[model samples]
Target: MSVDVITNTSPVIWLGRVLSGLAIAFLLLDAVMKLVPIQPVIDTMQALGFNSTTTLARGLGILLLGCTVLYAIPKTALVGALLLTGYLGGAIAIQLRAGNPLFSHILFGGYIGIFLWAGLLMRNNQARALLFP
Candidate 1:
């Protein structure tokens, strides 16, 4: 494995970096909102058929934050991606059950997940090789 491969500073990698930062910021904000359990968060959870208890919300927040943190780390991004995939799957399911819009709501997680993986693939040689080669 050449250092050049891993140390790429191409436009694609830069784009990936930007996308990853955006995704991480989005996930972090979501986790914080869950932990905070503001009225909108509680209402959304309730609408999603979930218990609006602070305990549950906080626990989910911790889990999401942990996964997002892992994803943000270059060394653990793969594991974090896998964990977040499952989390996004759950979100998709909830939105589906709630009869939300197909593209905007039901497939929103998939959209984010694509960006997450795309960023990883572009920014990480190991990820690109594993996924593409």
Candidate 2:
């Protein structure tokens, strides 16, 4: 019988981990900032036509934190990624409605989504196989 071996030391795996880590870090930071309801965050939310209430910010932060946590877990990463994609899509819509710059603001969520999926595809054999097959 042949044993299937997975090597974590591969450079490609390392690159994938790095990319995923960066996305996680950024998302965590964003969640924390919203949880804190910092002045700048509140100001930005108001500018985006969202309710500037601290309660709303905290609620959003909690949702984001939960999603990010799921994404950080290997088993639930796909579900988390899907949730994040939905969240990002909403963000993109909001930015577009606010007439934000296309590249810098409107498409920012797409950029993050790319990194998220790319990292997952590279590191997870199951994901790659599922997609490619």
Candidate 3:
């Protein structure tokens, strides 16, 4: 005779998945907007004192896309998170330099960073072990 066993996933894991998905979706949209160089994106970049050139926007978009892809992959997620942290840090700096609002503009990147890392920590055992242990 043989016995069968079933395992159940924790709700926390599901929450993590949802959070990760939200972060990914937002980032992907932002990247696409940058890549396409719409008027609003160009206007925002200029407001932030960036060059607002199509080439620069496309370059940033490509970089964001690569980092987001890495984060989406389980194998390279840690590295991707680290890279994204840096990217978001730069964004925060830019927002601050531009004298944007504290809660809305400057902290927006912080909010996203929290979601990214929190999702990773909750969903990834390796990440939790590395950080906690």
For model 2 the TM-score comes to: 0.91
Q: How well does model 1 score by local distance difference test?
A: 0.89
What would the per-residue lDDT of candidate 3 be over residues 71-118, giving only the tens digit for each residue?
999989999999999999999999999999999999999999999998
Model 1 RMSD to the real structure? 3.1
lDDT of 1 by residue, 1-133 (tens): 7544654768878988988888899999999998998889888899899878988899999999999999999999999999999999999999999999999999999988988987887788887766667
Query: Ranking by TM-score, best first?
Result: 3, 1, 2
TM-score of every candidate? 0.91, 0.91, 0.93
Q: Quick one: RMSD of model 2?
A: 3.8
Q: Which stretches of candidate 1 lie over 4 Å from their true place?
A: 1-9
CA RMSD of all predictions: 3.1, 3.8, 5.6
Per-candidate local distance difference test: 0.89, 0.88, 0.89
lDDT, residue 84, model 2:
93
